[model samples]
Target: MPANEKLKEKISHLPHKPGIYKFFDDNGIIYVGKAVDIRKRVSSYFNRSAQHNKKTLKLVSQIKDIEFTIVDTEADAFLLENNLIKQYQPKYNILLKDGKTYPYICIVNERFPRVISTRNKKNDGSRYFGPYPSGTTMHVVLDLIRTLYPLRTCTYNLTPENIAAGKFKVCLEYHIGNCKGPCEALVDEAEYNANIAQIKNILSGNLSVAKAYFKEHMAAAAADYQYELAHKFKQKLDMLEDFQAKSTVVSNTLTNIDVFTITSNEQCAFINYLKVMNGSIILTQSLELEKKLDEDDTDILASVIVQLRQEFESTSREVITNIELRLPLDNVTITYPQIGDKKKLLSLSLKNALYLRKEREGRQEKNKEMSEQRELRVLETLKKDLRLTELPRQIECFDNSNFQGDNPVASMVCFKNGKPSKKDYRHYNIKTVVGPNDFESMYEIVTRRYRRLLDENQPLPQLIIIDGGKGQLGMAVKALRDLNIYGKIAVVGIAKRLEEIFYPGDSLPLYIDKKSESLKLIQRLRNEAHRFAITFHRSKRDAGTLKTELTDIKGIGLSTADALLQKFRSVKKLKDLTLDELAAEIGKAKASILYAHLHPAEGENA
Candidate 1:
């Protein structure tokens, strides 16, 4: 637990930047701190000649792992650190809890609603845009809106009657061309309201609507022969395009999406959430969770989505993750993006998850042991980790294998006491599920495997590993439910992304420590199942190709195919068959047809 040679070596990767760094014990969060220079500040804790402080020394002694988040600036780090420390309430930080709040952009309630940033949300009929990631983001957005719109940023109430009577005077904003003198009726309410409508669309992550509105106005003005008006609308469209060109990525249509990634140790899970609006990341943060069971990555991400959406008051219905998540949330579309900006967001979340996992796992190396004691330990850990009534000494992991909807197959590999029990491995040629539907393939295999086991009075595995996230796991669970054996054995899904452990009927995935034996055992079983499935699939394909002579021949069906195979098993043997020999088994006409099909040059010469 001390900052020894290993800790010294690990800290070398720490960058010189403003960010939040965390120290942890074997169990959970212990301390969180922010630094202007994270490496220098963290490096000071292990300095030999540093001032002897009782509390600091005690905190350093229990440091088993380290993790951090890098930010753009010191102020962002400060805010993030404060946000995290307050959220986690780490042991080594200040205990004051009163000074905690994040910034939100508020559109003030008035005739010309003044768009401004505020920490407080008021219920005065004004619309609010964000709890943006940082103040810098809020200011940038505010500047963009102001530049695009000529709305008055003043305190005056520009009522229709007041404007008609000319009760208000032109201000500095009007003189500077920032406002259209709405106070003096120089700009009508209809025009000002149109601008407000466009601003609302932009704030609501509907830039496409705003852009279309401008383009429509431009087209209409041109059609009416109003060259001057058309030029003004063209100018607005050009300005909007120029603003969009500076965006992180604005060429894509993806908007109003949330991305999440999860990483875990045996004790805790770290989940990162990103909110994207119009191809721009508006808010992002990573949070931790204490695992109560063998939770999977899908479960952890699902729970994190619910918690973070509530925390940030976000209503984004589209969520992108590396794995498809089946969440309890209604009207939310959870997609696994294979490409585009959404994929980038998913990758970003995964990168954060991996970084956190590396920080936690860098301190320990797996002890490869095969003793009876080690076997018992793995079983005991498995039982406890899964909260199972029986030890998972007998484990079966299932994986579905397919290549572009061909030769769909499933494989089940058995493991006893954390080691492969290859004698009981099973392979299944998919019968029920057509094409490359993995979930249905999994369902078909699970039903067939367990049904046969029950019929033959064979022992069922104490655990069943679904080599996927929630979807395939759900199919297995459904199979268990169909057989009326839903809860008799422990079942969990291991996702390839973030190595997340998912439990059925849970929202969050149980993130096990990367070095934990239970995860290692699960990973082994998963790999073995995948390997067996792939090998079987490849063998099936190879056998099919090898015996393709009968199948490739013209007018040869399975029945006749068997006849030809029974006579001449190989293509070379069939090629050597004379017309008279083929006619003995097949009809003379069929024999001639086969000869012409197989021997094209000889048929032509004859």
Candidate 2:
């Protein structure tokens, strides 16, 4: 295996320190690797005595150049290699096939921190918890937090100066006891942060701390003879216990450890991770890697261990895996249990990995069949992108149109199985809202549309799209909340400016790829809604103008004006008609009055 002279010279000068190395071909970098001894590692690839696998032989054959970055330690090298593999996505590195950004519970860094679910983890100093593998589990944790301790959900800047200056008011959440009135300074900063601290503990898998806090408060309230306050604390404690019990408890002995397992075929590998806290599984995640080389399970698992631990920020000292792998994690103990509670935990993790592999295989089969129907494939894409529990077979989008508050109207366009269901489309004349209030108009139309569906026992749409920003979307959420059907169906708002998708209660908007089919489908629905609303609004405005012009005449009334407009489509066309032409369509008296109103100069001349 003789390398090029230039490559040989470059490899000869490689550092002996721990670092990452890259192999570049004519096109670009094809592989990235980490090594404790960079010189030794790169030299092994070109040694004629060492037999190499097919993938490695092919990779080494294309090596036109080599680059290396020296780092402080082996751990740093591993981290850099993983990051480069993700960034450049070198051809020969293990490919993470999921291509998904797992959701994390973000505690926004602000005066009044918002606890919300976000897929993005930023470095702005706010705490993030759980790149949760399951959205439902993350939501359940979030719901429990909100239930036990009321936090502000509104994206209000509740600074000290703003609160003192009376710049904000308590919202409906405050009235409903879902938020303490922190905006108006009714809740002190210290007390609010105390709740945040407990929230952090809970999210960090220290449920015992939260339970103890509630118990201590409950005891104090009871000692003060405040039965109601004591009862509230007791309820919170009970909820915490219930939540804890629901989590899988693999063992009472194995505390604060991580369990990992891996399974693979020739093409790809699957790895499952379990974060165990106090002998209970707090988090479960599975990852898939496409094997470009003949990498063993030990190497794949070791890479995933570093990646997942860094992602989830696990500081557990002990890690139990199904296979043995030596890693350079500081102060961490890696163990492979043969039999015991640790073995059961390992078995549980392996089960999840196998299940994920099975699910992916089945999905691939289903996707092949789905390719036959483009609509189904698009719907599948949408379902995955939006994290919807079910396919959006039926989607309805709403848009409102008005010109300076007159003749306001709204249109609801329905798409069934990725195609317009024209018969299911609807138009609404603004009934409740007085002026050009898009938010209220959206609320009214959404309410009216769904209420009618509910009344008639018709099936509701799987998803609702509001063709506006967060304001309009929030109002729709309020309407659904009032109707007690807020979470029954999935809904999002799409802003036209950037095509930002706003989920209910999420302050941050999701920006889908500009070229994605899901976004294209959403945009089509939005455009259709806008076009429908604009057309209806134009008709209404024309009708209103025609009526006003004709009724201004002495003898004309509502029915007569309608009759004249019905006979002739627009006021412009009616004005162009002769008086005899108008009289032929309507009665002589009303027609003459309308003709006079239309042609005032002609009336005076006659």
Name the best candidate (by lDDT): 2
lDDT of 2: 0.88
Cα lDDT tens digits for candidate 1, 279-331: 76656776656654345666556545665676578788887777766664557
What is candidate 2's lDDT per residue for 1-606, written digit by digit as tens? 123766788888988999999999869999999999999999999985258888889998888789999999997898888889878888898866457777899999998788999998899999999888878888999999999999999998887888899999999999999999998988888999999999999998778889999999999999999999999999999999999889988777778998899999887899898999987899888787888888989888888888788777899999999887887878999899898888888888999999989998888879966764988889999999899999999999999999988998999999999999999999999898887898999889999999999899999889999999999999999989988888899999999998999999899999888899999999999999999999999988888888887778788778877876775668787776676766776767877777777778876887
For each candidate, give its TM-score against the true structure: 0.40, 0.56
RMSD of each: 25.9, 27.7
